[model samples]
Target: MPSLDDQPAASDLHHAVLAWYDMHARDLPWRRPEASAWSVMVSEFMLQQTPVARVLPVHEAWLERWPTPADLAAEPTGEAVRAWGRLGYPRRALRLHAAAVAITEQHDGVVPDSYDDLIALPGVGDYTAAAIASFAYGRRHVVLDTNVRRVFARAVAGVEFPATAVTRAERDLATGLLPDEEATAATWAVAVMELGALVCTASSPRCGACPIADVCRWRLAGHPAYDGPPRKAQAWAGTDRQCRGRLMAVLRESEGPVHASALAAAWDDAVQRERCLVGLIDDALVVRVGPESYALP
Candidate 1:
């Protein structure tokens, strides 16, 4: 038999986290029992590298416009980019559109049930596929998203953050924590994720209120500062990302194809502006209509 030192008791950890979630979980629309698989898939796409509050309004508007994958797919991919509206990383919008088309043509507008099928969709990576499979289908897959990984890093592994990239060791630890029952494992996945998102945040963690605080290895170890490679803050202003955002804003608000000069008016730097516009066109966020004009794709 393995010694207690080998791992935390899964039963106790699940009980604490799930009991906490029962009281404290956020009532996100995608989490509603009635929420369809398509809704959950869309939420996962919008939530990538974006905050919940920012994603909420956009998500609601998007669903209202395109109620199903087929509805979104039936529209031009450019329409998806237009509706995306300042969500940042407009590339996600493009990929989501591609996924919707794939879902409509391949899966009969139903989001795939198996991890393999979900991942096969464009822009649907490991985490997204696992999430759709677990949350939508109530499967017992190991869903190691950012929030879940952070929770595991501190509470289980006694670390300030997970590795810069997911390691094999991390996957094994996550798999080990999977609840035996499929439904319980699904709940455990989202509950742990919620705990990290709301309580054990990157900075200013409210550990005192965390239900699993008593058992958190990082707390028991005195919450040492991260000693790994420094985490870099993403720069927005004056970067290509910001430049792209400005260019996109012009395109999003325009009625007809925007002239090169019209797009140029959004940014002062002619060179950077041109680069961003070309980048947007390459990403399929914009379609060049004429020699000197562009529109949403």
Candidate 2:
């Protein structure tokens, strides 16, 4: 593990990253110069544990409907949940809606410019907060996501892979690598993340096209294979998560509230279906409209 104090100068790396990004960065909607802070924040939340390709259309449609925090805040939570579509984790939509409400009520209906204030919002974790603060507000923050972490681990620490999650050491190192100019550092953060996503992938990395391949410590260290345990694949069909999504989708598409029978018909397993509904209700993703009817909160 390389300490922050021992890391290489970030200027050269920053330039290299920016150069690569200028040529190869994808034209993501959130990264557009005209995109609002709320749009960037929404993209960050939706991109969590989900791919950019899958998030693109959903993000566009969402922005088209609710361009501002106030717009989303004015709508019912059910709309947000229903608009979430098959994004796997429906809870993110609920959290995002809550965050929008917080922004509307607390932050003058504008996404906060400070990292602390952004992170303080409901469901805004370190990654989302840093991303929004840096990408949207041009604040000097070390945007450390999974992709960024992997890039740093391989390039700086010479590790085959990153730890299970981000750590303090990782944050410190990332901070060290940030450029002197805040805007440039923010752009570099996104560029590095994009590089990891496009070229230095988890599976078969296209090292031939990598900009920092020459400086990659992992590659210079004989390109050793990752020795960790094989990643376990989670099943989607018949799972509680799937059942919960199905139930929420029905409620989201409904105008008022959905009947218990309508929700029950979504899943075949009665026990799993009921548990999913209860879990969603407990999580505040769904609310009881009547004695036996449920709708998204």
lDDT of 1 by residue, 151-233 (tens): 99998888889999999999999999999999999999999889999998988889999987777888877898899998898
Q: Name the top TM-score candidate.
A: 1
Model 2 residue pairs with clashes = none
- Writing each residue's lDDT as its tens digit, candidate 2 over 56-105 gives 99999999999999999999877888899878688788889999999999
TM-score result, candidate 1: 0.95
| Runs off by more than 4 Å, candidate 2 | 1-9, 235-237, 253-256
| TM-score: model 2 vs. ground truth | 0.91
lDDT (C-alpha, whole model) for all candidates: 0.89, 0.86
Clashes of each: 2, 0
What's each prediction's TM-score? 0.95, 0.91
